[model samples]
Target: MEEQRAPGQWWRYGPPWSRYGPPWRGGPDEAEPQHGNRRPWRSTALLTAFVLIGSNFAAHDQPHRVPLDPYARVLLLITSLLLLWRHRYPVPVAFGTATLTLGYLAAGYPYGPVFLVVAVACYSAVVAGHRRAAWASMGLLWTGHALVALWLYRWLPPAGDTRAGLTQEIVIATWVLAIVALSELARVRREQWARERADRAQAARRRADEERLRIARELHDVLAHSISVINVQAGMGLALLDSDPEQARAALTTIKAASKEALGEVRQVLDTLRASGAAPRTPAPGLDRLPELVEQAAAAGLTVEVEGEQPPLPPGADLAAFRIVQEALTNVVRHSGSRHARVVFAHDGDALRLRIDDDGPATGADAGGSGNGLAGMRERAAALGGTIEAGPRPDGGFRVLAVLPSRLKEDQ
Candidate 1:
């Protein structure tokens, strides 16, 4: 059977209403409000005192009404005390206070700060999102008062009280409507603040994920290229050690230089991991470092032939282009049987184009090379609205072509 919602219960939301069927309980989520439950003692005490004293003054001013007696004072105190648990039991308290307020009216006690307790209870209920309950309780009080003042006053205490005026009833209704409007406004502002805080948290997580991916790609490219060069030099050093000691010494020197450069670049990358906000010790490498790439490829026994003028690119595009070239050359050194490779740069309208190719008969994982390096290359280019295309040529060779926007940073 579907569980039925309580009459005047709030819409299902927050922690309180979730288990109660429908979004219909008025409990203020999981934890009680800071100002509530923790210390209702002080405020309720003050409210009780005010109602008692203010009703005394009102009795003196309205001598036609019943005098302030022990019963009337205790009745007002009980009405205020209901608010002590208003946060946990908003519906019950709303009804409790409003009903007691009507009883005080039936006794013909002079109105004073006695109504303040009713207002506070209704306020708490409406803010807790039990709007229907608050309205029902308040309606009960007003309707009961109208009955006594208009028809039943002839039989009640303190004789000769005239029938209540319609204007007076209208005035009371206007104030209640105003309080409900203000409560509705407060609820909307609270929900909006919660949504904004959630959005900011999600955005923070997205940026963190992007930063990690960038660091991973940097480490992959740096280690792959440097290790390939070191491996080649180590092999040559071992082969020539006895027969050609001088050539072996040259190979060792090349190995030392390559290791030192790799260490510096690795240190640069680690610095960011250690101290996130610190400025990098060295600026990022760009297309201007093509000579270093050629040298590294040469150390690995591959000859790189260059052609065409390289166009200037945005900082992001520049770094991506340099990494693409570096990864392509590293792949050639590792998997291509060809000792010769060609790099060509071209200008196409507002874009800078790069093409790297090697003459290849066949080598497993050559050019198409597992797509890890290729995927990294594609990610970099796509971040700046660029593209990377790499594959084995139809005639029998490998090719990597990239087209990047020259003014991407300015446009962004």
Candidate 2:
């Protein structure tokens, strides 16, 4: 269920119907209506202007060979006044105006611009999405106008002036139809714009989700690899504490180095979260740091041989490739029984290829049936429009290979 907002709380953010709000509240949905409680002064002002203009015309020129009387003038004023609440109660206002218009027409007075009020009311109804009510009111208005025109032509008009009355009726009918058509077109355009906004909002949310997933994968790879090395070193240190003091001291040193590196990387991740707009304190770990990663793996009893020629890569692809290598080596150290591994990096025109082969058992965790490390590597590769292949080699070893595009299409 959707959460209900507190009463009067919207005023603190902005007007009740305004889009602006506190950052925590989330943005308003463009597809939803924004009907504020405050009086619609603009509509009131326009109606006031129309009433003044209509009154001036009623006082001077007579329409339909009939002069305006006090009763007809009162009805015209009442119809215009009803429009002040058109936005709040569009159907009621429209009905009220239509009733007053018919009364004015039937009173044997001039057609003193009562149709202007009815037209405005009809437009308000349509804008408020009350299409059926607007159409019904329009029908009632046209029917009333036609009946009044026929009555005038038959009884009130001079015999030779019948053609003039008919022409007046035709003009009024055209005006009413034009107003209805324009209002309907406006409603359709508004609906189309709202739909387009909704689609764009959905697409933005999907992109944000993908970006968050990518960042999570990077954090996972960094933590897993560093912790694995620390765990291994700490275990060796504890085992050699009494029997071989020097060996134990050396293990403790490795543990300290690994923990320090882990802390720095963790700080980098935290910085990324805290200050997205600020420059990073340290650049993301990329191909340049591959040697340090290998050294760390070596200290954890994994003899890793590095072979690669560095090539220029987009920042995203560079970081992803480095993470892929880090995750693969970490898996070898944690799951593979063998201690020797070889990492080969090669550039192939538009793509950067990575191959990590380990002389480990064919059937092991690192052989890549299903593990988070392998999954993370695959995600990184695929995000950069690349692919990963991991399985047990035929010669009783495990191999992980990744090929990443040096420049992503989005980057281009």
Candidate 3:
């Protein structure tokens, strides 16, 4: 006994019984499948040509056979028309057209090119990922053909010869097998291409996310350091405006310089985003600008002292070291209450080490406090296989120490 399929399983295994609802509708959790760039008109034109050719062949080849009645001709036309919707509902269309072709054949209509519609419909089902439906339809079609051949051999005098009948069946079977093989091969190739396209899209998205993170880090380092300096200088200028005109004028000059530098750095970042083919811009700030940074800190009422001999560092290490010092000093100016800060840079064998300490009262900045500056500094150091430690110093103020390889392994 054949097992009966459930209602929901019928749509998966066989053709839909009705076509009243929207063609693309699905359940809330299921998305309707999209057939991109499919040209239904091409299939329609091909099938229409097959119908005409088959009709003419039948008329010429079977002159003694009775002509197809109006109803049989109409059924053939309807089967051909169903090809128009094959791509949208491939399984249903294949089954429907095959059944209609069987009906026309059983009505004793003269043999014609009606099998072309079945072949094309089976191919469409396979391409749409309905392999089970394609195979089932092909089985039914082959069985029907075998039954028709057997009946013709038993009833008709000329087709009754067993040798001729077997030869014809063999030829028909070979043609059907060839069509199924070619369609399955085409379906496999299409699936492989789709997988490759999806993989490429996923990789591109990952690269975009990484680039966004890098740009964010650059912006944070630039703006945080500059804004801290400007804030300190502006506050100093306001305080000394009535007390001492000379010091207030110097403070205003420092604020202007800090703001100008900040604007230039910001413009460089924006230019990189806007113009891909633009000429090379200025190189990033490094330890060479340490003295200017120290001067700016001094002008901001923080007494900063620098000690050590700078070594020839890799470009990545140089930039990392500069940003580390800049962020450390910026925190001192903005968060720490003490005004005295010390920066020490040293090349210890294979590693370059930097330590920035300030004798300021611990103002919660040492406890991983309220910003991304400390996190940014740590990230810069770690990117070059380095480490950074920032916290409150025992019996004193906050301290930051970063160690990095003087030369990267890749450069070596």
lDDT of 1 by residue, 80-126 (tens): 88887787798999999999999998999897887888888888888
lDDT tens readout by residue for model 2, 254-352:
888888888898888888779967878989888889889888988899898888877778898889888888888888887888899998989888888
Q: Please tell me which predicted candidate would have the highest TM-score against the true structure.
A: 1
Highest lDDT among the candidates is held by which one? 1
Residue pair clashes in candidate 2: none
- For candidate 3, the per-residue lDDT at 291 reads 91
- Kindly report which residue pairs in candidate 3 clash with one another: none
Rank by lDDT, descending? 1, 3, 2
- Predictions in order: lDDT: 0.84, 0.78, 0.79
Q: Enumerate clash totals for all models, in the order shown.
A: 3, 0, 0
- TM-score of each candidate structure, all chains considered together: 0.79, 0.77, 0.77
Error of 3 at 212 (Å): 2.3
Question: Candidate 3, which ten residues in sequence have the lowest lDDT sum?
Answer: 13-22
